[model samples]
Target: MKDDSTEISARRRYFRYAVFSLTALLVMSLGMAIVPRQPPAPAETPFSERARAAALADALALRAAGQELAGAAAGDGGPGTDTALDRTVTLLTIQARALVLPGDTPTASAGTGPGHRTAQASSAGVPASPGNSATPGPASLSELATDLAASGATRLTDALEADGGMARLLAGAGAAQLLAAGEIAALAGVPAAELPGWQEPAGPSAQPSPARGCTSAGPSGGADGERVDPGTGAGLGAALTATLDAEHQAVYGYQAALTRLDPTAATQASSLLAEHLDLADEAETYAALQCTAIPPTPPGYVLDPAFLGAPAAGLARLESATLTAFGDVVALSAAPARGWAVSALVAAARRTANWGVDPGPVPGLTLDESQLPALPDRPENAALTASPAAT
Candidate 1:
């Protein structure tokens, strides 16, 4: 009986030991699954291979987002980076940090007296102190042009004088203006270049104020004379042609409206249609005079088939769309080429507005806030020379 008791105790002890081992094994597995070891923090990586890969991925994502914001996709530089240009811009950004001001107004030095003078109310206008003719501004574009020519100024300086030295001149005055306007663009606190970006202001500086340079002379009068260059005629003529093309397309679209909708519904639409046709004819006449071959209808220009009802209404819709489609072409065209296009667009827009169609105003046909083209520097640009005038 004592031996039997000893054997039972031994078996019991063995069983307890087995049970404990199993329990311990189970607990270890559970702990492992519930809380696995954490990966090392990424920042701890010191230029490791995996870290570099991660950094590159983040950079790519940022670049893609940036490209989208600029209205240009990642592949827009046409599949290759202009490395030299990129480097140049980077350098320029460094330099422009100084010596340049963004949108800085001229320092006002208490003009006149106690009361603030409106822009024109300066004391200088109160009869120049004695013999000085109010610092003698070049009274006319001609006088300014003469001054520029006499200085034998560089192309850039000539443009400044031509346009009244920022105190005057508007854009697209002439080649000199075009070049000069473009020259110092880089000097400004921005990515400057030879011509305006298709994307900023038309020039490096402010818009060239308008002037009637040499217009008083009849193509051959004299000191107050315009230079007559066939080139000028050609440019203007080209612009006229482009205007006509746009008008024709627009008119055709309006015609389509007449058939698709009720005549009564189109009465006002038809009137707008008539106006476009008249403007088109006028453009054609201008083209006839200059003899420049106008380009074909703007690339991808199409009739709006979707707007079959109420041509006038359809025009209202398509006007903005069409102007945008052609804007790039106008932006990229060379100076001489662009002059007429801009003028044509401006005139056509105005005429269309007068017809009560309201072609989105000048903004519809010009640079706007959303997308700015690079501004061009003033260089000698096309001017109305007398020789180019019709006899």
Candidate 2:
């Protein structure tokens, strides 16, 4: 079973303070609710009426939120949110202490000029505003924390709002921030090890290459569904060899089609074929780091240029040939090794189609996304060139 390692890891800091750190976040999140809001300035000219309404609303919201939090497990707080021990106590402490301050609102929201000074100095039935929105009055800070721990936040939105109104409480609330960071850190773990970010850590740039032991391409070489033989070498080298073979065949088929197509289409196919060649060369060089005996064969598969007739007919045959060759290579690969070759073939076939040459005239097999490059999260700029037929 997949453990909450990810979640727990995210709340590492909170976990550091107390084992029940996550519990705190969960409990507080459960109780979040919207307290009654202050009345609009137009509706209540007397600030006292608006303030009373706000307090009343806040109380109801707090009560409702508290009930919710009570039933939820700490699991509900999410990774790193360690709402229970860290956020809950911190927020509550702020609010509890804040309730003692005298102000128009939390953090000292007060009218400036002569009025505020008079209100502060005299306190003769006048409301003293907050010094800053970021610094809620002591009473507001305490109440706000109390409200959040009780029931005010449900989604991330609520949490943000609660934070906004509880400045004094948030002053020393670095713990909540840690919880969020912890969750993010946990998620970043696996991928970080496998695929380094732009700033990669430099270690020993050298590694011993695996020996190439196998002799022939295994019997599995057939269609898109074929697997590799256990007879071959492991990992990057085996994958590179397989891909290189496929690239060679694809290049050959593309050249065969070029002789039969219009000048424009032929030129395009030639360019794509060159790209495959370049990719193959790169794969071979990189692959040298893994295995020794990568069989580089001289160009053999091709039709006589004189036999090339109708552009359409030539393309149709070439596509069919390339597709079948792809299947054959795949059949020769082992299960783990098939993924790389499959990807190369699929990408080549798609680019071939961009030349407007459909091998379907000869029953070409369908290649799938599983055999191509990783799909973008959102393919906003997806474009397929007009096929030869379409043109």
Candidate 3:
């Protein structure tokens, strides 16, 4: 009887142990089943990378439109259309090269001939406008003009989001696109009213006051205008000061040019002169706001003797020269300032065009065409070559 009792007690102990083990395992399994697993987070793209991709995408689309325009021009588009198309193509190609980052290879749709490829909407969330859809053949000149204008508008929007250097680049490219579009539209018989107008971005409520201890000297007469000291630092202040000085010089140049220009030309010069004076005042206000010391404007500026012989040409040269300063302002400033700078850039470029000089591919940023990245090795890009002016 004693041996039987011991065996029963040991069996009961073993049964309890097995039940505890099973319960523990079941609880662990339930816990695991009840909990959910989280997915790994995606890495965020950098602004620079995103900007470059967007710019390149826009450039490619512009180039495709340019190619279509080129074909149309070749086939009786209109007089001067060939020249306009050449410039348009050149601008698109240079902008594409500028947007290419180191180690990046731009790819286009394969098997499409020049003017045959459809423009892809920018991956930067820009939606395609009407008539931008892929077609069986080349797009009409009007359609191409619309695409260029749309792309230009997209670039301007992207500029607002880009860093300083990139903002300047995009602004210039955007201006180029608009200019090219206008030219092509004229050739295509599209009404000027039909082109989309670029709306300036909203500016700050009020210009900031100048810092303490900052002051300005009145205008002084000198053969060469007094150079404003671009403050100790390189920034918006410096850019504004430089632009102010450029405007002063421009005011002087326009005045001198007006003396030699024909009545018709003088009227335009006089109007532009007033605009330059206004710009000078605007720049001065901006500089003071930044606490930059304003130097006295020189009464006279050194002019090229050639300017006397060809005042109109000289004015174009003068206008072209001011672009860099305006571009600097665009790069260094925020809203209102940048908006002003962009308007200045576009106006200057248009003025240059009026004087019969083609503002090269990128207006503000001076680039060595030889150093720019070559177009990707693709069959469709064969006809897209940089123009002489681009160089």
Q: What is the C-alpha lDDT of each candidate?
A: 0.34, 0.35, 0.71
Instruction: Give the candidates in order of TM-score, highest first.
Output: 3, 1, 2
With a 3 Å backbone cut-off (N, CA, C), the pairs that clash in candidate 3 are: none
- In model 2, which regions exceed 4 Å deviation? 1-243, 252-260, 282-292, 302-307, 311-343, 355-391
Considering summed lDDT, which 10 consecutive residues are worst modelled in model 3?
382-391
Tens digits of per-residue lDDT for model 1, 1-391: 9999999999999999999999999999999999989997767422222222221221122122222222332234332233322332232222112212344221112211111111111111111000112232111212222221211111111122121111011111122222221222322222323222211113212222112122332212332321222323323333445556667777777777777656675786687678777656545543433343445555435555556534555666544434432332243333333333344444344334433453431222332423432222211211111100001
lDDT of 2 by residue, 231-298 (tens): 34233345556556666766676766776677887777787778778756645643443343678575
Q: How close is candidate 1 to the true structure, as a TM-score?
A: 0.31
Model 3 per-residue lDDT tens digits across residues 1-391: 9999999999999999999999999999999889987778988766645656656765765677667658755857555877778778878888889877666654454433333323444334442322223333565777667667766666666666667788778878878888888888888899866865566666556655555344443212221232332432466767888899888888888888887988998998899999999889888877765666778878788887898899888888888988998888877777667788887888888888889888877788888888987766433432221111111
Instruction: State the displacement of the C-alpha of residue 135, model 2, in Å, after optimal TM-score superposition.
Output: 46
Q: How many residue pairs clash in each candidate?
A: 48, 57, 0
TM-scores for every candidate against the unseen true structure: 0.31, 0.28, 0.77
**Which is better, 1 or 2, measured by TM-score?**
1
